[model samples]
Target: MLQLHPEQIAQRLDQLTELSVELGRGAAAGMLHGGDITPLLERIVLVAKDMTGADGGTLYRPSADGRSLEFHISINDSLGLRQGASAGVAIGVPGVALWQDDGAPNLGSVAAYAAHRRVSVNIDDVYQSGDFNFSGMRAFDGHYGYRSTSFLTVPMSDHEGELIGVLQLINAQDRETGLVKAFSATDQRFIEALAAQAAVALTNQLLLRQLEQLLESLVNLINIGIDEKSPYTGRHCQFVPELTMMLADAVHATTHGPMADFQLSENERKQLWLAGLLHDCGKITTPVHVVDKATKLETIYDRIHLVDTRFEVLLRDAEIAALKAQLASPAQADEITLALREQQALLREERDFLRHANIGGEGMSPADQERVRHIAQRRWTGPDGAERDFLDANELENLTIRFGTLTDAERKIINNHISVSIRMLEALPWPKHLQKVPEYAGGHHERMDGKGYPRGLTREQMSVPARLMAIADIFEALTACDRPYKKGKSLSESLRILGHFSLNGHIDPDLFDVFIRSKVYLAFAHKHMQPDQVDAVDEAAIPGYVP
Candidate 1:
């Protein structure tokens, strides 16, 4: 045994007191910062090891079932043990102290004693029990190689008087002889303070976990709602993410390009993908009626049917006039019959011409052109039996429509959807990576030559991603088999049209070239374009578009 001076003892006590103060301060700081509890608990072990002069220590918390206490954190010789070791609540020496009460193997003994007394337990001897008989003491004693004369266990409780955890200290040094001895009352008090601080930190950590979970659930629900709104646009939310990732990957692989700043790390790539998926989330605000509109005359109430009804009235009037003329001049019936027949034939031709013109997908032919003129020139009697013009002269001569799906006004509203998309996206509280989504998605209709509607941004003003989306949108529309307005264009025809746009500066010439050369257009065509249309393209005849 080695003797220590009074000054040395005081110094040792001061060090132990300082350890408690530092542990409490650190735990409080961590709680304030919303940090995890594991670090605080580990700090407790570190302080315990330093103060008590032990090689290691473990912190235990009760499991959900409350049947056993589990090791929440452990510090062993500057090395931490992995969570959930085989040391059960009742298998180790610490567990014996944690589970014991009144010198016997009472399962609820430790909990009852702590609750009833509201005080910590300090066991100075394990081999010889003075008042507690822990059943697992022998197993605990053997595993730790403890010929211990003294041990201390402290119950840590929160301000609400809830048991947070337990702290155990082993082998205190004897003051008189400098020999190992059981932990004293002072040691118990020191550990109790540390345990209290740990409790506060743990509570704060649990609260943070709950908040994070709530946020995640909310984001997921919003994403699901965005994905389910459109029938034809189903899987679009998912596809955008995939395509964006692919583009990002390609950009990263390039050694020289304008995309150098856009090179993304793994996490940044994931964020980009997420942003792409949510880019059109604002489309939820768009009217579903407009989204599904398949024709120029489509609206909440169609007016094209009214035009058809008017044509039918003209046909009826022509027949009625023919009958009236024949009945009124029965003596001149042969001349009248021949004249009525010719007039009836002319009216029939005019009605047929109007019908075909209204349908409008076929290319205009000479016969169709002449028929249009005849319909425009034809006259009829009004409901009041007065002569009236069927169509105005200028309307008859200037009605050169190439498509039947959308009128000039309806097309403007449809094109203005991109602006609606922008406004809708601007309303969202997007993360940094997704901040550009509104810009990219809203510019899908913009052309390179500043002819596109809404912003009419020229090529330099738009992003490459926006350009890609524009091309994809056009290509999809051209070859889609499901549109009600027109037959799907053949792949050859679609590519030729895309090439024409590329030549005219409506689309990115380089990207269009890349799309063809990389066979990406063909791949998209195969997947979404009609199979018969896909077969129409001659690969050999198609010009190389990509450098």
Candidate 2:
């Protein structure tokens, strides 16, 4: 038997202790960062080989069905073989079966035996031992012209004593003569400790990833509900996040801007992405009719058809009066008929004018609004046999809406969605990395001058991601042609309005500048905007913009 001197034994003990410390530190750091566990697995095998002075090692994780041990990584310095270390090359070796077809544990393979028994198996030499099969190793050696010798297989288990993987090392070399030797008790103990640490780290990483995936699925579920509620808003929910990321990437890449110092880590980017997806989630609570108010006089249905019926009544009444007057005086029949024609022409002209006004276009001139009031003064007999104004109070209120289709009350209801979103998002218990989601999602509608909705937060109160979302949300709305009320504007038109907003303290000026200089709008336009809406833009012509 080969033995180490007292001094050599002491030096080996110190090295094993250091390796254990490094393994524990690495596992702890990986758990804290929530990164991939592949590196940790690779490190475990490396440490095992170092502890035993082994010339080769392989790590095996159980297959999904628990019926086989799949080769995850294999390293052989003597053979100059490195199969897996995150380089993604296929291992090319088949899995070691854990169970035979007879439904019995297959203890012939040393890795499988360790995994099934949940114990370490140390061999002085594999070619000389008959306890387990080494035929595969013999064949491998014959094919590669190498020797098959000492073997040490250890099972990795978590705290609950469930086997997670198996670590197998081969050909332990003597420190003095560089000859193959058996792994000692010290080597086995250190490897067993590392195996335990590795198992726990892998479990924690898998759990963390599962939780993150669950959160993302819930966010998507909310968006799907919103989509089923309204197709227009569903598109908005999808496009805004995409545009937000686009703008954020632009700001992150800019080196000369006011936001040059702004940077996003991987986790921070993920948080912002989730925030963008959920920004308009509160719209789900909004009344569908109010959100989809297509015309000025639209409710459950368009009330303009009722106005059309009223005009028809007036036309019939005018004809009946002409006929009665003709019957009363035969000589004045021609004059009465001519008067009837003129009256019918005037009524038709007014009716056409009202039809045009009902569209609720960009702006309503004062003269047009006054004309609607004048038309409302005409008397009409109701079905109840009482004379009433041509337009009801509600109809007058709706038709007189100066801007878009929504009235002030409906606008308030629409704006309340942001508040609802804030409440919903803030109710969730979030991790430290994602605690900013609510702030980023909720601050999209807030203004730079503190005149915005819900909280009316000023620019300084918001994060850069929040400001980026603001630009994204507004730009997507302006260029979107899917909305029921307004046609999408061209690139030049949207930029002009956005520039005005930048100067008017409606949005952050620095982000807006990045938005323009980076041409983020052009990228969004090409992807989501209509062909006609992607018009040429003159940077100098845009208002409130220096460029």
Find the candidate with the highest lDDT and give its number: 2
- Find the number of clashing residue pairs for candidate 2: 0
TM-score (C-alpha) between model 1 and the true structure: 0.59
Give TM-scores for every candidate, taking all chains together and pairing residue i with residue i: 0.59, 0.89
Candidates' lDDT values, in order? 0.60, 0.87
Tell me how candidate 1 scores on lDDT.
Answer: 0.60
User: Candidate 2 residues 243-315, lDDT tens each?
Assistant: 9999999999999968899898777788899999999999999998898888999887888999999999999
**Which stretches in model 1 have alpha-carbon errors above 4 Å?**
1-230, 233-241, 254-262, 266-291, 331-348, 362-400, 429-433, 490-492, 513-519, 522-530, 536-544
Model 2 lDDT, full chain set: 0.87
**Superposed Cα deviation of residue 39, candidate 1 (Å):** 13
Using TM-score as the measure, which candidate wins?
A: 2
lDDT of residue 321 for candidate 2: 87
